[model samples]
Target chain A: MSLLTVGSVAFDALETPFGKTDKIIGGAATYITLSASYFTKENNLVAVVGDDFPQSMIDDLNQHGVNTEGLEVRVGGKTFFWSGKYHNDMNSRDTVEVQLNVMENFDPIIPESYQDCQYLMLGNTAPSIQQMVIERLGKRPKLIVLDTMNLWIEIANPDLMSLLKLVDVLVVNDEEARQLTHEYSLVKAAAKIHTLGPKTVIIKKGEHGALLFKEDRIFFAPALPLEEVFDPTGAGDTFAGGFIGYLAKTDDISFDNMKRAIIYGSAMASFCVEKFGAERIMNLTQSEIQERVSEFVKLSAFGLA
Target chain B: MSLLTVGSVAFDALETPFGKTDKIIGGAATYITLSASYFTKENNLVAVVGDDFPQSMIDDLNQHGVNTEGLEVRVGGKTFFWSGKYHNDMNSRDTVEVQLNVMENFDPIIPESYQDCQYLMLGNTAPSIQQMVIERLGKRPKLIVLDTMNLWIEIANPDLMSLLKLVDVLVVNDEEARQLTHEYSLVKAAAKIHTLGPKTVIIKKGEHGALLFKEDRIFFAPALPLEEVFDPTGAGDTFAGGFIGYLAKTDDISFDNMKRAIIYGSAMASFCVEKFGAERIMNLTQSEIQERVSEFVKLSAFGLA
Candidate 1:
């Protein structure tokens, strides 16, 4: 099974109470491809960067079996750049700067080879761009999972809502779910989301964990309690990558398998926050992930008889 | 096996976004005894209320198999009363009034029948009074679980710290766990609290669920996803009641049994918030509770292989 991920590739500068960094290779597509590569070898990414982006970074993706043929490079434009600061709590953050640059006119060009993609994951991007990629596809993938933020839900209401109907799974944080449905209770929010589309709805609650809702069933997976979260830069993207990637590899979207997928996603996101950007996610061994997954099983395991 | 519950029995007036309530029979011991009564016939309550506390309330406790022999009546005083307003989110609340009349000089008096109790659950109260009850006991119970809030941790550090050494288990919310241990990460917070004295620590996260920690093992039981939370008062005490009461009924303290106990506790707490104060908890049937516990088992069940 193959996984296709489309979003942004950029440079990020981050500052946290623990430390600060400058211009680390970061973006939704970058984290998604990197994290997904661990589970599925045929991880294809479609996004636009600029000549300012390092060739070595593209080579890095290739080394990890990430097919970057669909990644466009605008020779004269700058790569999308963002700067943010994490608060003392590490749960909420402030985006201090964002330069659209190469992403301003970005239109994903899916390669002919990617037309046969089996799984599609639309990272956090403008709903218009996400829908455009879906329309460009030659045929529907086995599953389509879309990730969006509150900004788009508020500003691009029509586009975002229409995109929701086309997705098999919709992923958003707690606040976005509340904003989208105008319901404070997540159970109600999820129920409302099911009516919109996306047989599956995932509400990400940072350290609290992720909730998976499929029809009437719901599964919750807790984030690993870390001693310190160095940076939360790409945790959500990494989570989506681990999630859909595992599903692609297993080729089973049953509610039971989705529960395991979320556990893996939580494990990947846990590692993503151990360092700035996607540094930790880039080098996790299968055994390491297996051990972390075991922790999750132990963390949430109980029996009734 | 017998279970002894000691804490305040008072009245509370609450206002929430859903609606407002007049002064109702509400107190830690009241909820604790009522919840535990469902699990054990030998549920004994020890606390003080005023003559203003109606005889009908005593009859109600008796109706639930809650022995009120140890409950004192301050003939000239009014019952302890608290008033609070829940914010829109219902996560945090604001205290509007606190009238500790009979509770001002309250002292728990254990009845002769209660001295043979095998389980002692000290509901949220002043650490000094909790200690007084423990010192007056004829013999140490097989297990003692204590519940306390941030107030005691902030104002009675020495007392709270020393009392932690006396109990078999301690229950506190996520914030209080951090406050008590000075560690933001709950995993580390649980570890630090372990060094204090109790062999087990249960960190309650309200609607999020409860985490039970014993030595190197950690178990998390999630609260059932509800359509609405009518009221959240006394949820923690009710949880402690169901937990120890179940343990007393089974007479097993193994980690595995504690895991089941927490699940049962979570089910009881889930029902607690379905209606105002203890109304929902009072009317739950054995089959209904078992059904809710089955839902918890289903909510958390997953396969690793």
Candidate 2:
């Protein structure tokens, strides 16, 4: 099975209580593809970046088993850059700058080889661009997971609504889920979302945890309680990657398997916050991941009999 | 094994998005004893109420298998009363009025029979009063679980610190846990609390879930997602009651047993918010409780292999 990810791949400057960072390689697709590489070898990235982007980062992706053939490089254009400052509580942040240079008119040009992808991940991007990527596919993927933010739900609601019907799973934060449906209760918000589209909904509650709602069944995964969150740059994207990556490797979409995938996703995300950017995730061993997964089992495991 | 609960049993008037309630039978011990009654028949209550309090509610407690011999009624005093308005999000509320008529100078006198109690629950109250109850005990109970509020943490700092050393387990909400230790991270907060005393700590996160930290292990229980939360008053007390009650009934204080106790406690709290006051918990059948516990098993159970 193959996995395709299409979203932003750019530079980010971040400031947290711990310290600040210079321009670091951080983006939805970058985190997604890099994270997916840990679970699957046939991970493919379909995102656009400017010529100013470092070739070393692309080589890093290749070394991690991510195919960068579909990643486009625009000549003589500035790379998409974002700068933000996290509050004392790392849960909320303020975006100080966003330059959508190459991302201004990102056309997700699907490669012929990517037509074999069975799992497609539409990372955080404009709903219109996400829809375009879906339409350009030669054949629909077996599973489509879409991640969106409040900005799209507010400004491009119509596009987002239509795009929702085309995807199988919708991933959003707790606030976005409430804002999108105007329903304070997440169970009710998920029910309203099911009416529009996306039968499966994952509401990420930052440090609290994540919930998976499908039909009449619901599953919850707890976030690992860490001593400190050095930087929460791409935790959500990393979670999404681990989720779909495990699914692609296992090739199962049943609710039971999704439960296991969420645990894997959560384990990956716990590592994402350990250091700045993707530094920790970039250098994880198989045993380290297995040990982390076992920690989750220990953190939540209980016997009833 | 007998369970003793010592706290306020008074009246509450609540206003919420769903509707409003007149002065209904509400208090920490009212909810705690009522919830624990479902688990243990030897449940004893020690609290002071006014003659103005209804006899029907006392009879209701007796009917629920709770021992009311220790519940004292003062002829000339009025019952403690609380009034609050829940915000649009039922998570936060505004305390509009408080009349500590009988509770102003309350005395928790341990009865001869209650001295045989193996488990004791000191519900939310002044830290000084909670400590007095423990000091009056002839012999230490097998297990002591204490629940406290932010007010005591703010005003009675020394008393709370001393009380913390006297208890086996401590229960507090996420905010209070953070405030008590000046640590934003719950893992760190629980760690800081360990040095203050109590080997076990349970951090309640309202609708999010509850986390149990003991020794080097941790366990999480998810809150059942509901369509609506009628009232959130006394949910934490209900959780504490269910937790200690189950432990008393089974007479097991091990960490593994505590994990199961948390699940049962979480299920009981799920039923607490379904209606106003203690109405929903008053007449629950054994089958309903078992079914709800099974629902929790379904909500959090996942397989890795």
Candidate 3:
């Protein structure tokens, strides 16, 4: 099974308590594809970047086994650029600038080779665009996991709500979950969001952890407690990448396996926060991932009987 | 093994989002002893309450296997009274009034029988008083656990720091951990606190969960997500009690066993917030406890391998 991710593959400039970064490779699809590549060699990206995007970055993704055959390069167009300044806590950030030159008129063209993708990851993107990618698929993927932000849930809620019915899983931060469902209690908010259609709801709480809710079962995965978080810019996108990547590689969608996927996602996100953008996670060895996963086991493992 | 708890045993007026309660039985020791009673029948409570306190509450403690012979009823004095209004989120509350009547000049007299206690839990109280109890004890308990609040960290910090050196474990919420050690990262905070004295530090994060750090090992126990939180008063004390009670009953203080104790503590605290005061926890049957513990297992259980 292959993993297909659709979202932004652009550039970003970030300032954090840990220092600042110049225009670097940052974007949901970029991270998702890069992260998923670690687990599966057949990661395909369906994102549009302008000719201004560096060719070396694409070669970097290619080195990680991420296929960019479906990544459209618009000639003479500027790649989407975003700049943000992080507060001391590194939990919240303020957007300094946004240049959506290429994304403004973006169109995703699914490669014929990508038609066999069984695990589809719709990274944080416009609701209309995410749905368009899904509608264009020759056939529905075995599993569809969608991630969204408060922006779409507020201004494009109708479109977002309609698209939710077609996805198998939905992932959002805790604050976004509250804003989307208008319920403060995550347990209550999860139930309410279930009515909007995602059978599985994942509420990411940044440093706190992530919660997985479905039917009558819920699983909590704690984020690794680190001494310092250099940058949290692409942690969530990397988490989504790790999640679907594991699912695609293992080809197991049971609730139990989803819990394992959540842990893997958390482990990936933990690495993402250790460095600016995706520096730490870009070259994680299999042993490093296994060691981190073992730490999670020790962190949460306990027996009552 | 017997469990001895020393803290306020008094009345409280509470208002939550669900509703309000008139003067009801509430106190750190009250909740601590009651929660511990479910695990160990040899639970001993030593606290001063005014004659204004009803005898029925004493009988209630007796019915729950909690020994009240050490409880001092100061005739002509008033019971400690606390009133608070909970915000919508139930995480933060504003104390409207505090009448430290009998508690103002409280003296904990360790009953001759309580001297045999092997496990001691110091509930939220003045660090001076907590240290006094440890000093007066005939022999140091096998394991001493101290729970404190932010007030002590601010006002009685010197006394608290001295007591921390004598205790085996120290329990405080996330904020107090930061306040006590001046470290924001819990991992860092726990390390600094360990140098201060206690080898074990449990940082409670309310609804999020709790983290236990000892030696080089750390364990995280997630709080059971609830649809509604009726009241949050004394939840922390309940956790401490359950933790100590389980440790005493099992007579195992090893790191592995402490992990199980934390899960039990979290499960007990989950019940504490389900109703006003300690109503829900007071009547919990053994079967109910086992069921809830099972729920905790299910809530956090996942297989990665």
Candidate 4:
């Protein structure tokens, strides 16, 4: 099974209560492809960076078995750069700077080899751009999961709505869900979302957990309670990666399989927060993932007698 | 096994986005005893209310198999009264008024029958009064679960700390847990509270869910997602009631059993918010309870395969 991830692959500077990072490897596609690589060897990335991006990072993706032929490098432009500072709570952050040098007016060029990917992940980007990628695809993927943020929901809602109709699943945070639907109750918000587009919706609550809603069924998975969250950067993207990656590996999109996928996504996200900017996610062992999944099982498992 | 519940039995007027309620039969013990009655028949209630409190409510308690011999009715006094307005979100509320009439000098009188109780629930109240009830008991119960609000943590610091040492479990909402421990992360907050006294800590996150931490084990149970939360008053007390009630009925206290108890508590609390103060909790069938518990199981239950 093959998984295609489309988003930015760029640099990020972050400052958290624990410490600060210089420019580190980041971006939705970076986290998504890296996380999905663990579960699916045929992980393909379609993102745009600039010549300023490091070659070693691309080599690292190659070693992880992520196909980078679709990753475009602008001749003289700087890589997309974002800098943010996390508050003491670590749940919210303020973006200090963003320079979409290569991403501005970017065109997604999917390689011929990536046309066969069965699972598609449209990471957080302009809704119009996300739609463009889907339209340019040779054929619709078996499952399409789209991720979007509040900014787009505010300014590009019509486009986002149009994109929603084309995707199978929509992932957004709690606030975004409420803002989009004008509904305070998430159950109602999810129900409204099903009418707008995707049959499946995932509302992510950082540190609390994630809820999966489809038709009349619902599933909840709690985030691992860590002593400290070093950096929350890319945790969501990593979650999306682990989720679709697991689905791709299993090649099953049933509701039961999605439940297991949510757990795997949460476990990967638990690791992402342990250190700054996907550092922990880059070097996880299969045993660590298994143990973390087992922890999730123990954390929520109970039987009636 | 018998369970003893001690807390305020008074009146509350609430205004929410959904609607408003007049001075209703609302109190910690009222909700606690009512919820626990569904699980344990040997339920004992100890508290003071004014003669103004309806005699029919007492009869209602008796109908639910809750022993009210320990409830005192002062002929000249008025019942304790509280008023609050829930914000549109329903997660936060503003206390508009408080008239601690009978509760101003509530002295919990342990009855001969209650003295034989094996389980004790000290619902949210002044920490000093909770301590007095424990001291007056002829013998320690098999398990003691204490619930306290942020007010006690703010004003009765020493009394609350001393009471914490004697209880087997301490249950508090997320904000109170953070305030009590001065730690933002709940895992760290629970660990800090563990050092304070109680071996077990349950941090309730209203609609988000509840977490149980005992020894080195941690379990999570999610609050069932609802279309609307009619009223959130006394939800915590209802949860406490269901928790200890199930434990008393089963007479088991292992971590595994506690997990099931938490689900039961959450299920009962789910019912509490469906209508204004104790309205929906008053008449629930065992089948409905079992059905709600099954919803919880289906909500969080997942397998790797």
Q: What is the TM-score of chain B alone in each candidate?
A: 0.98, 0.99, 0.99, 0.99
Provide the lDDT at B34 for model 4.
Answer: 95
Looking at candidate 2 chain A, the ten consecutive residues that score lowest on lDDT are A296-305
lDDT of 4 by residue, B1-305 (tens): 89999999989999998899899998899999999999999999999999898889899999999999999999999999999999988989999999999899998889887888899999889999999999999899999999999999999999999999999999999999999999999999999999999999999999989999997889999999999999999999999999999999999999999999999999999999999899999989999999999999999999899
Evaluate every candidate with DockQ and list the scores. 0.72, 0.82, 0.80, 0.90
| Candidate 2 lDDT over residue span A1-305, tens digit each | 89999999989999999999999999999999988889999999999999999999999999999999999999988789999999999998999999999999898899999997999999999999999999999899999999999999999999999999999999999999999999999999999888878999999998988999998789989888888999999999999999999999999999999999999999999999989998888999989989999988887888885
Sorted by lDDT (best first), the order is 4, 2, 3, 1
- Which residue runs of candidate 4 sit more than 4 Å off their true CA positions? none
How many pairs in model 1 have backbone atoms within 3 A of each other, for residues 3 or more apart or on separate chains, i.e. clashes? 0
Tens-place lDDT digits, model 4, residues A1-305: 99999999989999999989999999999999999988999899999989988899999889889999999988898899999999999878899999989898779999999998899999999999999999988998999999999999999989998999999999999999999999989999999999998999999998889999999999999988888888999999999999999999999999999999999999999999999997898899999999999999999999998
Better of 2 and 3 by lDDT: 2
TM-score of chain B of 4: 0.99
Put down candidate 3 lDDT per residue, B210-229, tens digits, no spaces. 99999788999999999988
What TM-score does each of the candidates earn? 0.98, 0.99, 0.99, 0.99
DockQ leader: 4
Q: Give a tens-digit lDDT track for model 1, residues B1-305.
A: 89999999999999888898999999999988898888899999999999899999899999999998999998888999999999988898999999999888997888887888889999999999999999999899999999999999999999998899999999999999999999988888999998998889999988788888998888888888887988898888889889988898888899989999999888899999889888898888999999999998788888964
lDDT of 2 by residue, B1-305 (tens): 89999999999999988899999999999999998988899999999999999999999999998998889999999999999999999988999999999999998888888887899999988989999989988999999999999999999999999999999999999999999999999999999898999999999999989989997778888899888999998888899888998899899999999999999899899999999889999979989999999999888888896
- Per-candidate clashes come to 0, 0, 0, 0
Model 1 local distance difference test score = 0.91
Model 4 chain A lowest lDDT segment of ten: A222-231
The lDDT of each candidate is 0.91, 0.93, 0.92, 0.94
